[model samples]
Target chain A: MESESGDKYAADLSSIREAQMRISSYIHRTPILTAETLNSISGRKLYFKCECFQKGGAFKFRGACNAVFSLDDSQAAKGVVTHSSGNHAAALALAAQLRGIPAYIVIPRNAPNCKVENVIRYGGQIIWSEANMQSREEVATKVLQDTDAVLIHPYNDRRVISGQGSISLELLEQAPNLDTIVVPISGGGLISGVALAAKSINPSIRVFAAEPKGADDAAQSKEAGKIIKLSQTNTIADGLRASLGDLTWPVVRDLVDDIITVEDKEIVEAMRLCYEILKIAVEPSGAIGLAAILSNNFKQDPISKDCRHIGIIISGGNVDLSVLWDSLNK
Target chain B: MESESGDKYAADLSSIREAQMRISSYIHRTPILTAETLNSISGRKLYFKCECFQKGGAFKFRGACNAVFSLDDSQAAKGVVTHSSGNHAAALALAAQLRGIPAYIVIPRNAPNCKVENVIRYGGQIIWSEANMQSREEVATKVLQDTDAVLIHPYNDRRVISGQGSISLELLEQAPNLDTIVVPISGGGLISGVALAAKSINPSIRVFAAEPKGADDAAQSKEAGKIIKLSQTNTIADGLRASLGDLTWPVVRDLVDDIITVEDKEIVEAMRLCYEILKIAVEPSGAIGLAAILSNNFKQDPISKDCRHIGIIISGGNVDLSVLWDSLNK
Candidate 1:
């Protein structure tokens, strides 16, 4: 895909391979988990790539580490910058700290207190932005102009996309016979990278994107054959409210076999199931893939019909306890 | 240790080693997890042996599998029987199912609904008993007499203790530099097995026991240098309410370095931290080891002064969600 400035940023298998080597020591090789109860319920063997256990409690660490560490000494002198709701901010901050560089994070003022604390704990300087996409961009741009810091776009950068692809390299090696890989899509970085890497390894392996019904821009974009932005997004999956970016849209359109949409209720139910059966605390965004499967949203896809062995990426585990408590009780 | 009839049922290093080999294919070798956040809070390096990820969602599986599979063909034909309030019942049921043997579980009518469901899901035939220890024992005896089924005592049996001891074998290999190991004490089965195996592997290694303050029989017994029984127990850690068994008392009295008691409030706090920091669902009993450390209950122990590297057993993750919600809200 080409950016507005006519810059091409495409992720390939070779780049992903290099990214894996780059972040090997920096990131955790999280375990692939299975539960008999989950298997029986889905009627298929499921392998969960638990990035919820990943360093920084998410897969965002992989991309953030790759982007921060890939910079040259001169480019890295001013450090990195990013605007995120939660995981990416903490990830970039930690990655910058590990590289002995400063990180400037522009976060919405309404972001969870725990997430804000996580970023500060990793030594990031935070700049509060008004709670909207445009305000976040404005604040990030001002920071960039004042500090000359390089912006590390969460899901739109080439390095970040390639870095996220490293998950497939590990997943494929961990469970080689997987017929379908389900990923929770937000700005589409995870699914874009995973699809490229998985299809490169085995063309027959299908990759499906799962998104919350409240923020189904990616699903709508896939059907319309172009990128579509949502007017308003409302879901408990706070991490997946962002719309698809230009860099990730082309990859999603060409490589992704299907997109599955699940309700907010389904996301909460899957979160509870992950706690009960998988014995892990997964945020709503992380559990959405399983939520789609449990809700039978994937049953309409022909490729998913023959899927005997499925792999899922638990994207992250960072949620506000109060919010979770309220939703679970409801 | 000997039973009242003077029948010996002691577990040695060799017996534990044998149990490891016998159940190697049946049980999971759960990972040893570390978190920098956790380490910073505890003021020491902590290695968590996550038995919560074990089959049947507890370390009880290892013991149950060992006991059920150790049966000779003639004995196997009759199947197995047990009465448990939670994990052990489900563990034995699943183990028996794996061996193609019928499992008869005598559960107290007041046992948690989820635990009862787990047992039934594993194909165990349930025979309900009145909600009392004496009633459970009588019902188990009657079932054994009527069906000719062998009883697999949860923690008292030699085979079960040996099986549970295998966790120490894996922990030692995974992190050989540990100076102390902390385990939750219930009937003292887990701690007894762990203490024996860890001390045998490294005589210098200290093994500590953690119990809820409301149910501190193990601590009382250790302090008195004799087995002590509690007439009534009160704690949120339902799994640790049982007093030390006769076969386990001698082992704890001789080998356990210290027993620390934590209040119910501390356990709930630790449980919340596990959810927030480790991103894992740990039941009250499973979290008591960390709870003890967090409460500073072990500060007076002289041996703990030299302990830099510590290992803790997260025993299980089978909690009632409604109770957890209430505790967390409070």
Candidate 2:
């Protein structure tokens, strides 16, 4: 649905459906995994949409591929540019590479070595930025202006949001009986897209956003009925530190039924459980949905109380092994 | 496909096919995972049959379910017994529990705490045995005699072999164009079952056994044309310590095309790769096939030379976290 402000960057169900067709061949239709242990623990049948197994090890690939492929020939010739030090950087880089297009990544100088290596491996040109978000965006804007490269904003772009919405299309088809879908909200593109597509398909299907307690701008935004920006954020789930974007805020506000917040300790515990029981190495951000469930963050919600079957989107698997080792050791 | 001496405990392709049908609903038809990174590293198209995602976290569940379900109501009434500290113990326990039958597991006193907990959690009665094969066997035998429980040998029995063979049936269907099937060998039940079924389906398909360099009894047995016992075996792949059994030896000799040995270091490296790139937690035993490929153990073989598509059966994921952490840290 279009935003009340009539913003050009608003995604609806039809746009997401188009995106699904556009990126079908370029992306993997990741498998849905189920574990009896996880089901018993949450007291509900949980279907895990394993986006961690997706190409580039995250669901970001869908949005990246869609954004890269949507560019017209002349527009694509100039290449694509993005500012991200997380899965989105690697994903956009790989997506651009797959399309035989140049990708300029504006990454913080202090970004993890592995993440930077991932972008480089995908043939992305790295333009170092200061560690702060403002500096990163400024560098990306300068590069876009200088090189005439297309700016593929991580979450603010309509194409990217629509691309991510394809997940709910596949998820609904995969598990038609799911009563609810729990998604991790970062800049909120994924959850916004998912909520739109899921609600459009099944209005009764509840969509819940799972936020890290350390950086809960989305939760606070839902409570205040307005976007809330955090001055500082701290969470092991580094991916969920971003505040809600303008484009995503409206979608999340309209379509999301509830916002559940889980602490860092809960995220780590859920990550450990995922590794042990699911035999899948999920990043802390990816395990937030499980953390929300385990922490009983949705216990009092009427929709969640009636929910017998739930679908959890595992956001990514680009975890630092040392951090995992430390948490597991502890 | 029967033993040369026509032993009662001999599994053939037909029996395995029957087992597949028998345990179809009881066991998960595990997914086949593929990674571009893994394929590039191995220089071959590798289809990983992830039995790590199987019921009870291993392929052993297929055999256990088949065995438990195959028994007559009268025979099942007396319950089942086995001696194991690996995936088989938990698999059998869960299988028996599904059938509402008692499961008695005789585990070595020094077995990993996690494994002991797994068996107990599955509602299996635990009988502590000394840390020796003979003591385990004696304790299991005594338990069977005292409780009138039928013994379900891990890898030596016909029923179990047939059940494990079912994996090949699924694997072949999942990746029908595989030129070679790589399996980890311990007592050789899995390989025997896989080889018999795979060869019976397509004689042109090469079946290779991946064994730990420290526990190369299968390789020695193949070379000597006799079942050779190891004086002492040592490897990070604890699941592959057992020597080839009489029932499985004949099948391996008749059907298996080659035996490839990999070092513990290679196994650990492959295990780490699985965790990192595949986003799956595979035990050292499960990673041996990849280790064999990575170590170039089959580089000279004509069959392997012609093999473009190789199927690797990930044997299990029942790894001790502490052991995995230590190995990864090191």
Candidate 3:
């Protein structure tokens, strides 16, 4: 089914299917989680896309694998460059290695050691930058120019967005009757793709976007009908720190039904609940949907009571062991 | 499927099947993991039955659930009682609640607050005892006499042994081709049940037991041809501290092929590997099998290369969040 909104938000199914075929062997078709405990607690049957079990410890692998493989012979010869705190860099490196292409990553100076080591272990050439999102992007751009490597924006590229949509494709296939879906939004690539795929498959399926209140730029942008940037991102959920991208802004605005925010404390509490009750060890970002539900933040909203089976993309489950202590203390 | 051996260790098929009927609806038929990530590193094809996601946070629930449900109508009308540091107490509470029966849990004075809170949340009556296991047990015995409530020995009971075997039954059904299997042993209920069910189903499949060296009374007992009580059990894996008992010891002797010991440090390293590579949050006990594989401690054992497929039961995924820091630092 072709999306009516065109390329701005609607992903090309043919392109996504092609990407899926190319990267199918390189990535895991991660399991879908039907958490009985969650259902019994929330009174809503939950289906979680367990991408924490995906290769490279996240769903980032899918987009990275697809983007790296989608490169033509000339682009492959030129190599690839990306900026990430951790998972995307590692994913791209592994994906590039599969294609025998060189990969360069610009990592934050203070990135978690476990995540930094993962990039080096996967054979990525890492360049350190100031421990800020702006520094990462600027260094990556400089590296791309110096090395003549093509830039692969982690969440802005069409191939990456289409690749991420495959998760929802799989989810809707496994659970065709899902009436509502919520996705954790960082730069909007994941939520944009998920919303597009979900709405296309079943237009009546309500698509929600959850962002950490510390970095709820996306929610603000959705209200303003344009991109909104924050001066500082201060959430324990390091993954959902970025504001929505220019390409993702329009898509999220047009396709997504609602954009909600969860406080940092709620995120931490949700992470602890996931560990204690589900025993799944979800990182802070991965627990936002659950946080909203468990905290009753979602019940008072426009989301209707008729939304029975809720499908939530547990975006990423990559947490540094160092963070676990801080979480316990909190 | 009944073991005609008539030894206290022998668990008949009817009892095992009855446990299945009792807890099947309440617990997750936890996923079985077969991954190249583990197999490639271990020099053996690995099949892992992840009970880390089990209800009440551990495989102890299987035994506790069964023991609670196995109570006679008259006895259940009274209540159930037991003493423990954590997991067993919580499991007993959950089990008794499902049966609409009263649960009196005698936990040690200084038991982890998280465990105590979980018991109370499940509608169980809490009885505080001396912090040490010795005093805890004495108080539990007195409570049983005074109350005439059934005392479900954490691991020494016949019903518990039968219930714990359900993991092996599920593993055999999922991966019947396995030639060797490993399980972490504490009170020996899990190993006793797994060994009986696995060997009974496929007699050629060798069943091995892994334990932390600090609390290796189970291994020592098997070597000495009798149960050897530990005056002071010490291990990072608090769950595997108890020694095997009369009922569980006989089954360990008759059915289990070999018992291997691993250091606490090795367990921590294995837990890290599981978290990083397998994307699973495993407690120290859950790491026993992988620890043996990582150390090459049992690779030279009689279970040769041709065993083809090897299965390990990751008995639980319940690590107190506070323990994560200790594991990471180790």
Candidate 4:
């Protein structure tokens, strides 16, 4: 009830509410979808919060929009800068374009052509960096210094956490009786925000983080009771390869009930089901939630045996199907 | 203001309204979706009526459910029968299953394995016939005679047309200001019902039929001012190959404003856009409406140049992506 005052790294429920109000007019209040056939297969009433239909085709737009709009007149005048090679780059670019400001995007030189095209399409200024975190951060820092643009970290900022947290508010209102929510954990911004907001709204609601076993940092972190960094990660889920941020790690460790890791084969199976059964195109990270729920580990877990009404957050739909098609055929 | 009475082949607005009331509990009020990027690409504000999300993954379920439930006690006990190798067979099977009655499906032996699985999944009694219309009809006739079952034509029957017409009522209500509606025409059932109901609601509203260029019987019939059956049809849109039936022809001849035929290439392109941009999986038949609007004929038409708000009915989404993936790769 105190709103977590004077906490720079934390985003409380009040902050999330404020972010929702600020970004309400800019983003779509995307619909919640359900399928009986899918329900019968998974043996749970799964309500999919389709952020895949959100602006820029991902939930990243929510945090980007909130961060860009929260700037003051002088801060806004200098523009915004971020280094991302995934949906966040396009989202930030589009959000800045909507606000009539320059977005200096520092993308790796080896980033996908489609992603680069998305940034250009949204009128973002592209600054190329080498394909590594140190090079990316250095390149982004140089751009921020040159343009005097404010830096918006992908998942570490309080504004971004609060923005992503808006999804919980909307999802709860859409499906009020959802006892459990499963969200994909990448940098933990999405799951951290979701866990905090959902638990704040209803203390009894359980939040679970879904992570690809190939990149199971979140699961390791939960088991160790501390943030775990992997030297190398491997997964088909391009979006869920990032390590948890300092700001998000605390929220994840404290609020998230459990982390369910799924294999790449299971994720591919879930993606196939999304295409054939649900008639929805979800990227690998987005389908991981469904994969986690259907995993044998979850089924065998005593705590999850009675979880009837579950919510799955489909994070994004920006995958290039040509690549997926080739892989499937092989 | 009087409802058309004593007409066995006709389905007016009132009939559609009654069918809506009768089948309201069974079918989904599928949402209408809008996309700004799609509007910018097509030069018109498009409202997509997502009947692809309807029961059985197609709008055929509506007509099938209406026909199955309209039967009297003894007729219902005898069961329902149909001959097809498409969404209709699966839809009819599901509808009959819902009513706890037997569904005698006379599917061609050459029908795709996925389609057969769908019918079997819905508990239909599959009867195999040779890969020809005459063979299908003959097998269906035998089944009807043996079981004393009522024949439910996929499109020709009044109950079927009335059920299909319910789409118009829902679409018009969802998008109240749509000045034009483009619907994919197969056996003319869907467009006939849409034209009748849409015109009844708003006399000046334009109804256009989107047909595949390879299977252009509807376009030929419009020019001839009479029904013209195709000797052989060829198109990627398997759903649009059926010729207009006698009952549906009259409605198309009197009410449909125009027919726009698009090539297979355009249909594939629309399907790509539906998957990549709309983030929805639409079959070739379902993508035809969007393809027609993007066609040269529709763009150059003087009547359509001024149309601002348009509604596109995505008919069905039962496509096998493995086959599509092969073709696209090739």
Which candidate comes out best when scored by TM-score? Answer: 2
In candidate 3, what are the lDDT values of residues A1-330, reduced to their tens digit? 433355434355666777778788887777666755678878889887777777777788888888988889998988899998787888888888878999999998877787788788778999999988878888988998899988888898888888888888888888888998888889988877777777777778898888888888988887887788998987877778877787677778887888778887777777766766666656678889878666555887756477789987777767777555334334
| RMSD in Å for all candidates | 3.3, 2.6, 3.6, 2.9
Q: Model 2: which residue pairs collide?
A: none
**lDDT, candidate 2, B164-219, per-residue tens:** 99999999998999999999999988998898889889989999999999999999
Work out the TM-score per prediction: 0.94, 0.96, 0.90, 0.95
Error of model 3, residue A37, in angstroms: 5.3
Model 3 TM-score relative to the real fold:
0.90
Model 3 pairs whose backbones collide: B52-B317
Runs of candidate 2 exceeding 4 Å displacement: A2-9, A322-330, B1-9, B322-330
Angstrom error of the Cα, residue B128, model 3: value is 2.4
Q: lDDT tens digits, residues B252-273, model 1? A: 8778888889988788878877
TM-score of chain A of 1: 0.95
Error of 1 at A75 (Å): 2.7
What candidate 1 gets wrong by more than 4 Å, as runs, is A1-9, A323-330, B1-9, B323-330
Over A279-298, each residue of candidate 2 has an lDDT whose tens digit, in order, gives 88788899999888777667
Ten-residue region with minimum lDDT total, candidate 2 chain B? B321-330
Q: Candidate 4: which stretches are off by over 4 Å?
A: A1-9, A323-330, B1-9, B323-330
Supply the global lDDT for candidate 4.
Answer: 0.86
Docking class of predicted structure 4: acceptable
